[model samples]
Target: MKTRAAVMLAPGEDWKVAEIDLAPPRFGEVLVEFTHAGLCFSDEHLRHGGLGDLPAVGGHEGAGIIREIGEGVTGLAVGDHVAASFIPTCGRCDWCVSGHSNLCASAANSPGSADPDTFRFSLDGNTIPANCGLGTFARHSVVSAKTVIKVDPEIPLDVVAVVSCGVLTGWGAAVHAAEVRVGDTVVVVGAGGVGINAAQGARFAGAAHIVMVDVNPAKLEFAKRFGSTAEFDSPAKAAEYLWSVNPVAGGADVVIVCTGNTTQAVVTSAYEMLGTRGRLVLAGMSQDVFEPNVHLPGTQIVFREQTIRGTIYGSCNPRHEVPIILDLYRQGRINLDELVSATYRLDDINDGFADLRAGKNLRGVVAHG
Candidate 1:
């Protein structure tokens, strides 16, 4: 099959929207006809030379229906409504067995699984990679069936697609990854797609106060609708406010950083804004050389006992969490529609990333054929 997709040819390059051929689904694979795709900042990283290796199709957050199922595939059939998980959870990996399916072993080879070590998409058989392997930028894509999850039919395609990454990442960071609780004060850095969800998840989890930090005015505004009790334009203010909230306002119980900025200074600041025994979760990615400089001072940690952890895809299980998160959306407990601040056609895809970087949209969706 041939597909029209936005191809990111290399690092520091713009995406090329063109027609390419798609291959048939192989073993344990499914082909989806996507109606909606979410433009994510992580994909933006690919455009700006992140982690190198490119000439790929990009679109991990997509909503569509199964059009075909490959050999050895069962439990998923054609015409089933599904949200395509960009990261495939093999269900057999050690992490999957432990309920942390996002770190599936299959995820490491997601880019290579399409077979021929090439791509279903090619101009003259030239290889093209898919961002997370479920390239929904194209009208249709053949993806690993293990990465696809059936979703509620009542949910809108745009709503489901955005949550496939942004919403789920943010929400899961607070719920599953951070395990937020009642009366706990949480601070979310970035205030964009992932950060806003963390704010909302903290609120839904009964947080006493939700503080959102972002440099962008627009993004800070978007975070407000998602249960952010307070907003800060800088981390300095976030730290100051953390101490100023109340006399008992020791510090933040949890801090989830989604900015993906690889600055040691930023990481250090995020780590410092915590109370005794506070948990700090790093949801952001640092540059290749950007290992954080963290001081686990015996006096600070032994007495306060701060725990620092890293989160991968919000520690989510798509098959288990997608529907659960969707139910919350349906019940109006979680704000899905608010997360979608803008939409684009597949042709205007690059503009979607522009909005994300400008912090103009909490999340952007691509309307596909």
Candidate 2:
């Protein structure tokens, strides 16, 4: 089948719309007719050569319908509504069996050549790579069966496609990874899709204070609607303001670093903002991993119990959190529409990323076939 897709031809370049040929499922794979694809920052990493990959089809978070199934696939049939999972969790893997499907070994393997199996997608009579193995940027894709997560019919496919990644990543970071608690304080370092979700998760977890820090003022306010107690572009300024309001625990209880591009200045500042026993979670680290400040804050970790963590897809199990979060949205508990500040058709995928990089939107969408 011929599918319309956007390809990142080179680093620091815009994606070009290309009509590519895609093959059907070979085995243990399923073909999804995508209806929507999300614009995530990680793709920006690829565009800048930070991810160190090339000639890759960029699309991780998306929603579509299962159109075909391979011979070995079961429990899912054609016409099933599904949101593409970035990670394909092999049920038998140690991580999956241990209730950590998010880290399934299969998810870390390369696409186009599924180590234990052959891929089903081909472009221009040749193989084309899928991001995280489920490239939803195209009109069609052949992915590992384990990566397809079912969604409710009531939810719009466009919304579900984007949320499964951006929303889940942020929310899961706060709720699952950080395990934020009621009356706690949280500092979200970016107010983009993932960071906004983190802000909301902290709110849902009943965090007493949720301070959002972002370079864009618009993102800060946008994040506020989702439940940010305060918004600031400067962490130091924000912390000072927080101290003014409550000086006793001047530092944040939990600091989520969503801004991937960390400079030397912010690196030290981020760590300095955390209080004793405070946790700092790196939600989106830069493509160019910078040196972290290991200088201790007076042995705070040992004396005060501080912790640092890197969160992947917010440490969420797709099968577990996708439905759970959708229900939260259905009950009017989460603000999804607010996150989608702009959207473009599949052909205009590049434009979507442009808006994301310009900091002009909280989130952008690429509607598929």
Candidate 3:
């Protein structure tokens, strides 16, 4: 089958909409007709050469329906609604069984072709890898069963799409990784798509103070609707506010970093906002993979008993958390509708990303036709 998709042909290039050939799903895979795909910064990272093999179809966060099931597939059927998980989970893996599906062993080889010699998507007879092994940028994608989670059909696909990645990652970073407790003081840096949810998560966890820090004034202001009790333009100002309110600790109980691009400087600033026995959660992706971006004083950490931890997919199992998140959405506990600041047609994906770069949106979605 031939499907229209947004393809990133090279690094530092705009996404190009092209007609590509898609093969039928093989055993243990399924054909998904994607309805919506979120414009996550991770894909922006891919556009700038941060993730996955090149010449790939872009997009990792999406929601769709199973149009066809391949051989040996069970527990899902045609017409079932689902969301894509960028990190594939093999339930038998040690991490998955231990409630850490985000760290599933299969993730090491993710977003790559199932068969190295053959590809699921191709153009002009040249093979193309799907970003995160489930290129929801395309109208239809053949993805491994492991990269998708079943969702209730009543939920809107666009809402489910954002939760699939940004919402899940941010919420879990605060609730699971940071272990936000009642009356805790929390700080979330970078008030973008993911960071906003971190603020909401902190509020849901009963944090007394949920402060948002971002360079963009608009983003900082926008975060208030999502449960940010206060906003600041820089970590220093936020730190100052924390000190004034909680002078004894001189910082927050938990600080979550959700910047579009993580940096050594950002990590250091986030760490400075942590008080005694505080936890610093790094949920952002650094541009340089090999760079040692974290530089913190070991003695201070030892004396203060502070912790610095990194999380992928917020350290929450997709299959387990996706449903709970959707349930929260259903009950009006989480704000999914307001999270989508804009929506675009697939052909306008490049423009959508441009808006992302300009900080014009909290989260953007591509409505696949």
Candidate 4:
């Protein structure tokens, strides 16, 4: 069938909304009709040659309904509501079996065609890969069952869409990876879609002080509503304030970096802002060219007992964590509505990303008709 989609034909190219063809799902795959899709920075990373893969569909975080189920698929059926996980997990893998499903073994391999020699989405016969193997940028998608999670139909799809990536990653960065505890001083860098939720997670985890760092005054102002006790326009200023408040420690208990463009300098700053045995969580996306600058000396890391950790999917299992997060939203524990700063139509994808680059929106969604 023919479907409309935002395709990144090449790196540094603007998203082009084109009519594409989708093949019927094969065994173990399900066809999804997306209701809403989130404009995540990871997709922006793809656009700017960060991932090195182009000619692909552009969105990963989305909520949709199973329009059709393929052969040999189980636990999901047509008419069921679902969310797309950027990282597909094989439940039988060692990581998944050990409750560390976030690092599924299958993730080590590329998200290739579900069936050999078959392409799901194509434009004028040229095969186009879907971003993260689950392209919610299109009106309809055929994704592997492993990457699709069942959700309650009662919840709104737009709210459910953002949780698939930013919400889960940020919230998990604090509660799961950072292990934020009662009365802890947590410093969250980058108060965008994900960083804001990191603050909320810290608050829920009982952190007494949630200091948010970002260059955007509006985003810092926005962070306060999500439990940020203080806000700063720069890392140096944030560190200064932390020292003033807790001079003895000279830093915070935990620091989470969720900026769109993470850097080694940012990591070093986060390291300097940690007390003894403090943990620094790097939860942002970055390009490969900056790989040489990601180092920290042995003395500071070993003697101080300070730990630095890199996380994907916020270290939370999607199939399990997605529902738990939705429950939080259902009970009014986390705020989803406010996270959606704006919405756009499929053709306006470029403008949506411009807003993301300009820091005008916490999250931008593409609402389909």
Candidate 5:
């Protein structure tokens, strides 16, 4: 059947909205009719060639209902609400068994390629790749069963969609990767979608002081509603205030970076804001092959016992965290509704991303009509 999709033919090109022929779900696959897709920065990274290759569908964060299930599928059925998992965990992989499905081995394949080079969509007989093998940019997709996580029907699909990426990554960065402790002072840089969730995670972990630093005053205010205790216009001010407030520690116990691009300045600033035995978490994306322009002085790091960490998907197990996160939203702990800055039709996807690039939105959801 024909499905409307946004395809990225090459780097630096606008997404082409066109009709593509979608095949039926094969073994261990499911057909999904996407209702909402989030304007995630990772998609922007794909557009900027952060992820090599092209001619692929453009979204990884989305939620939809199962239209059909292929043979041999279990634990999920048609008409079930679900969210896409960017890292498709085989469940038996070493990483998945160890509760770190984010680092699943199946990701070794190039984006959209699963089952040894088989393509699920074709445009005029030309193979089309699906982003992360679960492209949500299109109205429908035949995705690997490993990438689909069953979600409760009580929660809105649009709200569950953002949890697939930004929410899970950011929240897990603080709650899981950093292991934020009670009474800990946490500093989160870049109060966008991910950073705000990082702040929420800190709050969930019982952090006493949560300082959110961002250049945008609007975002700072928005983040405070979720969990931030204080806000700063710049990292320097945040560092100064930390020293004044917590003179004993003199800095934050954990710092997380959530900007679209992790620059040398941001890295170095995060380093400076750490207290003794503190850690800085890199939870954002940048040029895939670029050097981390800032250098950490080994002498200070060794003595202070400061640590740096790099994370993907916030070091979260998506299959597990997806359900837990949705539960949090259901219980009124995490406010998924407010995180939606705006909503747009599928055809206005480019405009949604434009708002993302301008920092005008926390998260923009595409509602397919």
Candidate 6:
């Protein structure tokens, strides 16, 4: 069958919405009719050759309904609403069995198709890899069941879509990775889609002060709605402010870097904001792989006992954490509705991303028919 999708043909090129051929689901896979796709900065990484190869379908964060289940698929059926997990889990893998499905071995092949030897999408008879193996940019996709979690139909699919990646990643970075405790002072750098949730997560974890650091004035103001106790234009200013208020500790207990483009400068600034024994969690993606992004002093880290850690998928197990995140949204503990600053049709995806680049949106959603 043919479906419309946004395809990235080469680096530094705009996404082209074109009709592509999609194959049916194979064993352990299902056909999904996407309802909403979240415009995440990680996808923007693909546009600049930061991750994944060219001639790929874009979109890793999305929620949809299962149109058909392939042979051997269980616990899901047609009409079931589900959210995509960028990291597909093979339950038998060591990481998955040990409660760390985010590091599942299957993710090693995420840049290509679910099966290393096959391609599920094609255009003009040429193979087109789906970004992260589950291309939600397309109207319909055939994805391995392991990469989707059945979601409650009552919850909005748009909310479900963002929760699958940004919300879960940010929330887990604080609650799980950083192990935020009550009364702790936390600083989150970058108030974009991911950073805002880190602030929300800190609040949820009972942090007394959740400081959001970002240059975008609009995002700084918007951060307050999700639980930011204060906002600053830069990490240096945030660090200065944190030292004044958190006199005893001298700085924040935790610092989470959620900038869209992680750089060595950002890492150094985030590290400088840490208090004694503070934890700095790197949840952002660094585009430059050739140079080291981290340049912390080993002596200070050893003496202060500060920890610098990196997380993928926010150190969350998609099947377990995704449901809990949705529940948090359902109980009003987390605000999923306000996270979406704007929405657009699939055809207007480029405009949505342009708004993201211009810092005009907290999070953009593509509302599919």
Candidates 3 and 4: which is better by TM-score? 3
Q: For model 5, how does the per-residue alpha-carbon lDDT over 19-110 read when each residue is reduced to its tens digit?
A: 99998998998999999999988888888765645778889999999999999899999999999898888999898898888999987334
TM-score, candidate 2, is: 0.93
Better of 2 and 4 by lDDT: 4
How far does residue 130 in candidate 5 sit from its true spot (Å)?
A: 1.0
- Which is the leading candidate under lDDT? 3
lDDT of 6 by residue, 314-343 (tens): 999999989998998899888999998899
Candidate 1, residues 18-68, lDDT tens digits: the string is 999888888888889999998887777666655435777887888999999
Q: Candidate 3's residue-wise lDDT over 1-369, tens digit each?
A: 999999999889989999999999999999999999999888887786657788889999999999999999989899999999998888998999998999988762333334554359998998888887889999999998999999999999999999999999999999999999999999999899899999989999999999999989989888989999999998888999999876777899999999988999999999999999899999998765556899999999999999999899998899999999999999988898999999999999989999998999999999998
> Which residue pairs collide, candidate 5?
none
Cand. 6 TM to true fold:
0.97
Weakest ten-residue segment in model 1 by summed lDDT: 109-118
Q: Where is the poorest 10-residue window by lDDT in model 2?
A: 108-117
Candidate 6, clashing residue pairs?
none
Better of 1 and 4 by lDDT: 4
**Backbone atom clashes (below 3 Å) for every candidate:** 3, 0, 0, 0, 0, 0
Native-to-model Cα distance after best TM-score fit, residue 66 in candidate 5, in Å: 0.5
Task: Report the candidate with higher lDDT, 4 versus 6.
Answer: 6
- Flag the better candidate by lDDT, 1 or 6: 6
Task: Tell me which of candidates 3 and 5 scores higher on lDDT.
Answer: 3
> Which model, 5 or 6, shows the larger TM-score?
6
